[model samples]
Target chain A: MRAAIPTLFILVLMILAVSLLGVFGSPLLLRVVIGAMINLVVVIGLSIFIGNSGVLSFGHASFAAIGAYSAAWFTLPITMKKIFLPSLPAFVLSTQVGLAGGAAIGAVTAAITAAVIGVVIVRLSGIAASIATLAWLAIVHSVFSNAEALTKGTSSLVGLPIETNLFVATSAALLALVVAFVFRFSRYGLMLQASREDEAAALASGIPVRQLRLFAFVVSAAVVAIAGVLKGHFLGILAVGQFYLEFTFLSLAMLVLGGMRSLSGAVVGTFAVAAIGEILRILSSGFEIFGVEVIAMPGLREIGLAIMMLLILLVRPMGITNGRELTLPWKRKAANELPITNDQIG
Target chain B: MNFALQTAIDALSVGSIYALSALGIGLLFGIMRLINFAQSEFVTIGIYILMLSAGVWFPLAALAAICVVVVLALVVERMAFRPIRTADPATLLVTSFAVSYLLQYSLVLIFGARPIGLDILPELARPIVMGSVRVPRIDIATIGATIVLLSAFALFLRKTRIGIEMRAAAVDFRMARLLGIRANRVIAVAFAMSGLLAAVVAILFAARTGVAAPTIGLELALVGFVATVIGGMGSLVGAVFGGLAVGVVTVLLQAFLPPELRAYREAFVYIVVIAVLVLRPQGLFRGAAARERV
Candidate 1:
């Protein structure tokens, strides 16, 4: 409970900052903040599993897709759905729910799907588990892309209400952060972290590693699912392509660059990446540097971002936060988590 | 029956391309436990070279592509991978992902993201009919080239000194090092071999599609990665079989699934991959070196 103070403090600070930005910042800044918050929610959700379990998952975007599509089905006005998704099942076609209700349903749908897949996924560890998740991602992407009757195939699914303003997106991010922080400090989280450190040892010590992994996976999926819902509602449209490789790469890069092992790292990484990305976008459109008119080359934003990530990794392989939670400067520093020395490549 | 035969031929050809790509991925994983996602970029770079050299003599263009791909593979390893060689698999994978993005967008900067249409070997696209069975010439060439390459790869591993060192290193890196095997040489050789295979895949893939795009190699590389996992990580033979299995299943799915379901063909194949992982977590063809050190 005492540790919660700093965490809560940080959360409040983030919310205030976002609210101020929402009020005073330009419309474009608010839009970028909203987008960053969505990504922050995703990174936090992903950290719940990847940070605690010491596994890499490339499938969370699929869960996000599931959430977005589910939200679309429930939230889209009935008359509009009847025309756009003409072949939606009778029950779905007739259903129309508000944003919150639809988001709740989407989260449940994603969690249930994660539970089912987690049974198969949690059995493997290390690189094999990572690959399995990738396979899962491919499977989901293909299904969604081909399910024309339900998802309209590769085409856009519009008509979702744009209810995700800065406040809504920030609330979602706050929810995700609270969930991740609580999970990380809980007994289950401790046990999962133990397993992440040494699976064989954890098993020997009577930890139910696989079951804990499943729980984390489901929880993470549900959080990312909400992010998916927010993205759909915010944009008023959804597409299967939106939740594929590019999104996956962007989110993962954020998680990794911030430090995958701590909730604070997840938050920090997302904001850092967003800021750098925005600045690069500005520079790409030509900016005066020291009174010199300089127009950056095309693709410079992507190239620069990639280079920054690589350079960061080269300097601090763990990440910017280096696997430790953030603490106020006046407070005593948190203990550094033991470095995982799994030298075997797998 | 002739139609069935034609379908079978198509499957083999597709399987051959995947096999080459998987072989490249498997070779690198065996030595370093690195899954080189940038191999996709290697394929892309090769295709771009081919596109640029379209009017040049065919053999020269082919040779130039192969050389550049091999050099690129080496440079990437030195610059991006070597710094993090001892990092965990997750870190290594992410690094490769970064390298992949870097290489891909570099191409986007050099040549716009749009696909360029150019037939490297237009003659190969023609179909030949034998006994009422028609087979595309590219298909025959793909299969033939795969067989020749695989045979050459096998002999190289068996007969060459560097090949023996690579095998030894894969078996036990620390032990092999103790026994005087040069880690740098083995790893470099593995990268060069991977590059060679990527070049072949690029040429064949471009010939089939008649388009050179930055994203063309993405799907192929993904299939290759899946095939490597299904084949059993670090196992050369497993990579080959995994590649073949994915290719055949994908083609079969496309042929038999209803028109409405055709687009989901790759999904079904990946489902099978997940099922394989669930049943046999060690992979279908387990590598010689036991992965679990504990």
Candidate 2:
């Protein structure tokens, strides 16, 4: 499955599906598609570490926050920087790289932060590791909220280019999907998966489990940081609160609901949740059905989404696809159909 | 010296909340191997109930709130956890997150996002002057309540048959079941006791803050969860100690750090947490759950 066309086919199919909407869908509908694609990019990045390595992370949103803010600082015009962040260093005040250069800077910065955090966190396993990741999230949120001179606390950072469209978002998501698929099949990824399945066995086989986890952690951080760049650019503003609890849980839920293990799971989960959310959002906006106008209902979408997630967990704990990779009809068997052992995931 | 004493009392009161929540969480982890993120919702629900019944006699309202919380906790056990008791830890953790999401959003729908004000615990706000240092009565009351609850809890665990069984279950759940411990009964009791702990935290926290909101429990629960982790998961005493340590460290850092850096206090506190986790993964107190055989 790693080398086959099934994975590629799924990625291309999702791109085309979303791109079709880009071309013909109403402007509001197009915005929804682009937003979901950006979410797909983040969710896929998260899956590369969480799904393969079997570690749950509540901190990846912090990486996204870091990337968004870094891009804001680097790409916003020098004039805007002076108005928003006068305390920024002289060079930073004058610096103005475009989106690509800004994203690269953000990704590298996030990757470095991950390299440091992962060294300590990867040493722990199971629920302890999960909790530690949460601690990292809380720390990032507090720092970003209070670092007034640098981040402007909770005030929105306006003036970033608002140019993210369906095509750009689809391409970014496709790039993330390809990178995640390749990494999942890489030697280090396989070794890390082995460690996830049976740590003692992996250790016995002389696999450097911690190092493999660190590798995935850093790469995933860079990928998520790119999602942050797109998000900041798309929204035309940056706020630390935007990257906290809601984003973290929503992304994690998508990965969990879609299927945690396979690339298809990430795409399916993102789309499934996004679709359900869209339907509910429209319904909440006082839609007319069968010549009867239903009044708008506040907070119903969130409530509906939460109920749906819980129902899914109860019915199919392994998620919608049960961690199976997408297989084309031409393929003989979906690659890696090994039974998902209970104790395997960290 | 006055400042040190001031910080100590402040930390003790603050830590007492974390310790109480962590204690409930730690108890469940002992018997059920669950992190119970929704335990915080128990606190939020308790406070909301308390707020609604504010016109009632204080003692009666509190009693009613406690009962409601206990029933809710038991319901969560019966509805969500009992069915998937055999699932892997990962599934269980994710399920807990789902449960949390359900409770939190439901709360938002019921009670709007805005924080509602109430002077819930005016008595606890009175200053207790001593020589040169002044402390609020709530500080003393918080510490006193913690001591009484913990002492009562320790006695219950040590002196009762169910308590002994719970300890046995914590050490070796399978063996305890083999020895005739009723699994459902024991698990229900764990949830009930943890609910009691959460109610206490809610009462104290609401008394101090005088406001009620949907996400109230989330922040406190996170603090308590952190305390449980640092104290050594599954160790009751460790959870209490860990909670106090976190509170003390937070206040001390705030007091001593340069004013310019004070805003980043949580960031500094988490750094210490990461250091502690890296240095002692089993935590400061090693319990049955921490004892892994290679």
lDDT of 1 by residue, B123-210 (tens): 9988998988879999999999999999999999989999888888877777888889877778888898899999999999988999
lDDT string, candidate 2, B1-294, tens digits:
878898889988888887898898888877777878788789999999889988888888889889999999999999888877766565566677777777877877777778887666677898889999999999999999999999999999999999989988877777789899999999999999999999988889889999888888888778777888888876778888888888888888998999989988999888888778878788788777677545
Candidates' C-alpha lDDT: 0.87, 0.85
Give the CAPRI class of candidate 1.
medium
Off by over 4 Å in 2: A1-4, A287-294, A329-334, A344-346
**By summed lDDT, which 10 consecutive residues of candidate 2 chain B come out lowest?**
B86-95
